[model samples]
Target: MSMDINEVPSVDPKEEPHAAPPRGNLRKYDPLDMESASFSTHHGQAAKATDWMTILQLAFQSIGVVYGDIGTSPLYVYSSTFTDGIKHKDDILGVLSLILYTITLLPLIKYVFIVLRANDNGDGGTFALYSLICRYAKVGMLPSQQAEDAEVSNYQLDLPNNRFRRASRVKSTLENSKFAKYLLLFITLLGTSMVIGDGVLTPCISVLSAVGGITQATSAMTEGRVVWVSVGILICLFVVQRFGTDKVGYSFAPIITIWFLFIGGIGIFNFVNYDPSVAKAFNPKYIIDYFRRNKKDAWISLGGIVLAITGTEAMFADLGHFNVRSIQISMCTVTFPSIILAYMGQASYLRTHMEDVGETFYKSIPGPLYWPMFVVAVMAAIIASQAMISGTFAIIQQSLSLGCFPLVKIVHTSPKHEGQVYIPEINYLLMLACVAVTVGFRTTQKIGNAYGIAVVFVMTLTSALLVLIMILIWKTHIALIIGYVIIFCSVELLYLSSVLYKFVDGGYLPLAFAAILMVVMYVWNYVYRKKYTYELDNKVSPHKLKEIADNLNFHRIPGIALFYSELVQGIPPIFKHYVANVPSLHSVLVFVSIKSLPISKVPQDERFLFCRVEPRELAVFRCVVRYGYKDFHERDSFQEILVDRLKEFIREEQWISPPTISSNGDVNGNAMDNGEVTNEEEEIRRKEIVGREIELVETEYNAGVVHLLGENEVVASQGSNIGKRILIDYAFNFLRRNLRQRDEVFDIPHKRLLKVGMTYEL
Candidate 1:
């Protein structure tokens, strides 16, 4: 059973207060002690037993949340591949083989079997991989981390010894290098940014491709009309994001399920009726023969061929929302077979009716099911967009919590689901970008290329991160790691090279988006580091805090004030800003610092680290509140919980005070018969002393609580270089100013808040 250190035994308050111990005698609080910390706020519960019904229910639910994006890929895979137009009979079998292998190898084998299990606790993504690597190594860029953080419940891992010299050297090298840390962060952010790019292009292409089916159904439906319709649908899809995914998951799962069933049913019909020879494409020879027949075109067509597994990353990225089993079960049983059959069925149709290559997906749809398929296709496209949008929100949320991205407003749309977040700024921005792609490109082929670029690049990054995980985290053998890297890298790089080849033809879009977001992330992280460094270097000493406490002119007001700090220890310079300007502070001042740890979830009991500053009569305390990326801070009751925990800390500290040994093994302010206080009588005396302190705190508890935050801004000094000036003054500052109200992020009430305005120059 876990210990709650705050559950100190009650003591009688009728006795006298103990005399204060000498400055050097008291036991300084150790925040690193895993046994003593306790918190009132509950983040998440532990996993429960997984019965068959629960697994089946979650598996069905995973269809909507996890597989939407990948399931919709069939709408455009064949169409995109034949953009130059499918001219040869062998090309049909070849393209189908490429699609089958790409889907079979990457998503089904690499992701479902390997990468899904690599999740940080229940979380997964590029960030999760990064988090996993960070836990096993000292490569984390966050400054406030301690050695004890590694031993936390979720982040804990046993390391291989120095006997494995190569691995040891590699780990040491990665930990020691500043460049390596930043590079890893840059790469992770790039992957996340590409997912944002996916958010933009996936909707455009999916919707456009789905709506294009109308062109086949009727002569009146023009490409222009289809584009407009797609844009409208994209608008609707993004607007409803405020409602949250959990609210709509039930509805979306059925549509996607029925859509998959319809496509699979049609696939069986076509394979049986049109060309059973399409089954031969499942063999590796056709993929080789297609390349052998048309080498250059085959290489370039890989840009198109990769559309088969476009949104497969979403399956892995959204693993936090849906577990690995449900995703794997849904994909293997339904999504995977349905999509494979859909492509094979398309291939079968293409062998005989070669003229309909561009419209093969729609044309191949059995005539009776065409209209129903189009409607389901549209719904599936919308569902696909919804999944990517939710994923974008999650990635941004993680980035924000990790301090890599500028602050943005995050709304938890569902009370029950912690991960179901919606970002208005990101949503509207994505909508505009999606609309622009549809308006400008107006064709699925160009948009498909852009989408392919985003998808393949994210895959490549995931593969790169996985190699490090296989080495450091999993501690796999060197031979196995090398083989994993080579195989995955070769395939991903092939697709990556194909996408890069089309840079001039719509592929530049995702690249541009990635570059822009990378710059934003890099700049924000740069400013964050500089600001953190300043706080660390310029912190107020314990002597200075004592002096502040001793001075009478700095009036102590009647309420409890929670002063927010960026530093884990010592006083932040922002406190200096406030003290210099203001004549008074609260009667009880609590220095509060919130840190995001590399772990997925910091257990509630271990969340807050409370330490009492010297001269307890002055009522000053410091708290370090830690959270993982997935942990959501409940805004409404956080202050109340924090105050209650503070009360608990004070009581616990008071109770532990006299019994705690001083230097040379003597108990502070107590007589030691033989280097220790005598048993029963001394214990009762200590209890009486603690009860007195509790009463004092109870008197101050009647006072209200106020929150203090720093309104910090970054500026480039005049003497700085033009490059620095442009980055800090223009780019980073603009994003900081316009993104969100940083003060609002804490959800502190305006009336009870104190904002100490400050500026820093680089």
Candidate 2:
């Protein structure tokens, strides 16, 4: 007797170690399930059974991931500010006041309080903001998006109503305008590229500044020797990136904790013994007075002063690793106060020892404590660079999934931590760049200039993007959005101007990096869009496919074949190319399209959508597998899972609409005759028949799943402009050739994969 697909035996939830709890009524409310044809309770929000130990562990883990970059700022901020020279008494108070307010406003007020709320579910970064905007508006750059993409849990937003309907206007404009969407993407990519530049500069400057402290310990230490030492340290840091951060990641918080306590303790000692009166610098009047007295000198000094907030962006970017309360409590109770006291201590010590301005961090240390503090400083610097490198990997991984970057091999270093990914190519490139900058600059002064540019520009871009989120996505009042733009943009643009003034003094490095990376992104996107349009225009219809399947001489092979492409609907033209040459096809054909949506995670139950291509016994079907940028594929046997899901889908479909044998002796359900049903009705009816039952024919287990992938070479058409030809033929082609293959990217085994090569002229 035939059985229902749902009756098929499978692993029990209690036995499945990773199975989530039953959803009960919660599945009814999930937007992802609401839009899909069916739903399962697989990916449910189970009540987490956690104790105090778990919370404490998360808090501790957060310090290492979130605060490492900012915690090490004390190593270099002072030296960079006094690089040009500072006045004896007044400059110290003014700079101290600037640093105090910069930290308070940017990291504490802006990031922790405001920006963290804008996270994509739990993930945070420039791309997170871009994804949020995409959901609210139809501005995603991916051409293959479907209506189901907006059904993800985090993608839900309030529809425009009579009360705050103005947001609809903004959304309409963005969605209708391709240029606006592309421009926003460009800004986001620019910010992302600068963050990678930060990864390069953060190590060179932070390590060099920390190691330079040894100069005061002994006269034998020279600037030349310090550069080499810093380079060696950077080499070691990047060298270990492949091993992943899981082993040392936990130690990060404790190391930073000790460093903060050490700096805070030293600050108190210096404050009490050297100059208690420097406490008055906490007042805003010092900032005002310093600027009035110094004029243009103070304006230029703002570039260096901004260094106090160098790794501030990391506070927001790494929010996915820890909760907001943990970060807030850690920052407010420990990091903020410790950093403030450290700066105050430096200002107080500088009151007497003006000559030690260049090495204030080390020189201000009490003679007995210098060696221990020096060791902590180096450790903190290593942690700082490590945080930056990891953050870069996460952002680039997001970029790759979104089609904004080339395919690269991603290795998950920690099985327990989903976010811990290591990219070998990126690690190697970053290492070389860090060492080159360290050897070339030979001092923190120039690297600081470049570092300042990267930090402020990223901040400025974030500020600009926040305006759109506030107005368009959040639907805040017009007056409030305008006010936010004015306040934040003015501050960031002020810092941008100061950094730009030092353009010749190493500020050009990040700008050059951003430009080169931006060009590569634009060229790749241009070619990708062209190829996508070509596929859509050349797609084969069901009528033509039926004709091919019905031909008397058509050859059919055994086993199931899954043909993968970027197309969301219809058979890809590449299939025709493959069949025309081979003159044969698999008995069971499934066209699968894997898409990365603009959200952080897609529910496992809602990830795959199956549909029948036509009403025929040919066993042709289509499947769309959707994933979010942060989603990780299960490491078990994907073939078994796919087959099970397919069987379940067929059973469900059969229960809903049983198939009938048609005149052609093919299994068909409610087959549409010519002109019998409207095209729209037929489409709706086709969706209803997706899960109809068909017998599952067994095949040799080893050779069962064959993945057919298209290998297409893209080239510009003849008579194209020199620029277009060069970009398409040389630059884009070069990147495509070096990128990882499709089978490797999707974890398809080489033995069962078949390549069908085709060339497209655009």
Candidate 3:
């Protein structure tokens, strides 16, 4: 008889169903069931503030974490821009106008309003953008995607009838063309690499500029002493990163808030007293006139002017820490105004004291408040560094989940905050890079060149990705998309060209860093995909499994064995290899495949999906444990959860197929054919069976639960080309030997673990 897919079988004895049924069993479980399962238990979007108080509180907190980097830009924007010194008073107005409009257009208009809306379930950064697009299109590099992944709550986007055709066309093109997919991947990796580079340069430049104020305060402090002080501060900043953003953000928020207020107040003082005429910079005509007058000089100065929006990407990158509303509220209400006034005030001060353009921010400060503001400046700089450092950790975590980067230890610093993570290896590397850059560059000018290259390149890549997001995901109008591309890309390209001019003069640092990082990310991803493909292609069949089980010499041990595999369907080849060599199996066998989805978090109830593999009495089951990019699974708790779920599945099977008596007085695994048993009798019998099953499962689990992990070595086949050989044999092997192993990542105890050795010739 035909049965509804969602309806659990009433008396099926040989099979057990699950939300995400294994491949080749689609007929048994409706595709729609999988879709419903994915969305029913999880939130559709990232948690958002529902009240004004929460929004305000988060906005205040964001001021410390998100706005620090951008807020501190005023400290060096003037000095960095007019490296050859300001020629005329109009130069001040021109640069200030550029700064005002750049911040307004890029950070405020483009990012806050537009790109912020493109976050992947409230998580931002280049990888988040890539994840969003991957969900909408079948362009992800991994071949392991299941239908449930597409049906994830936030993965499905609704489109208007008019836009649906266009969106579908875009998706179709991306799926059909391999080049488009690789191009998208390249753009994402490039942007991520640049952000990491910026993470290093930010601490160096921000701290150096802030501490350089010591020279202005007193000549007794040499430039060398200032550099060392900056280095010390940077070291301290990186050391505290292990504390995570929740703690660091709270401490940093007040310092950034006061820094903004101080700069705004001082700006008003300078604007009114020094040159009220500098207010004319609010007009775009000064930008045009100054550019026309200075020509190539003004064009080249964009490399420095771009630094005004240095931390703009941080606002989006750190979105996982705060909601979009909080970011918008904080930026528009607090950050934007304070920064504008700070620039106007600096320009106003420069209008009169053109000779002090090199030291405009400190020179503009009132003599009495110099030291106090200097201290605040240094503190704010460190906080700015905190924003980039935190963002770097976040991006790396996302990369790790997506299989683009090698495994690293990720510590979730706050129990209350899911997104606040600390990577010990990344933190120390950034600290060293920051120290080296600070000591190597010695001045903000050289570091600023490298900093500008990384910043504008990331922004430009964001714009490119956003264009696709607009078309395929947002289903935005073509006209609007074109306008966005023209406006944002044009300005970003101008800044990019200006920065490229300084490639020999420290601009190469970020590029060099990005190149190295890109190679590592690309090589790791290449080998990762190759390895997954090998496992998938060589998976053992059910026929082979039955043969292994039917062998007379094979014995079932009195314990549970969980064989970990990357493949979610058939048994991994390593299992076959293990059984062929060992000649033994556990009483209960579970093939566990841990899959990482593109979203932020998977619901606990929906995390484990159980399916019974054929050969009924063998006690073999498959469990797929799915995790999102931001989700964490503790070692002991995970095992407990898995065991409980297994027992629960056993009880469910017993309830569906209780023992019954046939007309011939024979006990069968179905309800009584003669109606000899009452409903209450059947209920009692089912409960007893469930109790027995649960007890048996508990006993086996208690005896010992062992984790069977594959210790596979990947190598190039003899017939493969030299390039493949080098990549697979040497590069991939080196990374594998150095990085964390699968068992270590899962924190499986050595006593409870068994490694099956094999070789994959790719």
Number of clashing residue pairs in every model?
0, 4, 0
Model 2 misplaced regions, further than 4 Å: 1-52, 655-666, 669-694, 697-703
lDDT of each: 0.78, 0.77, 0.82
lDDT for model 2:
0.77
Tens digit of per-residue lDDT, candidate 1, span 360-415: 88888887888888899899988887777877887787787677888777787766
Across 414-460, the per-residue lDDT of candidate 2 in tens digits comes to 77656667889899899999999999998888999999999999998
Question: Looking at candidate 3, what is the lDDT of residue 468?
Answer: 89
Best-performing candidate as measured by lDDT: 3
lDDT of 2 at 232: 86
* Candidate 3: segments with Cα more than 4 A from true spot: 1-51, 159-163, 651-692
Every candidate's CA RMSD:
5.7, 7.4, 4.7
For candidate 2, list the clashing residue pairs, or say none.
Answer: 653-691, 653-692, 654-692, 654-693
lDDT at residue 24 of model 2 (Cα atoms) = 16
lDDT for model 1 comes to: 0.78
Task: Report lDDT (Cα) of residue 450, candidate 2.
Answer: 97
Task: Provide the TM-score for each candidate, comma-separated.
Answer: 0.91, 0.90, 0.91
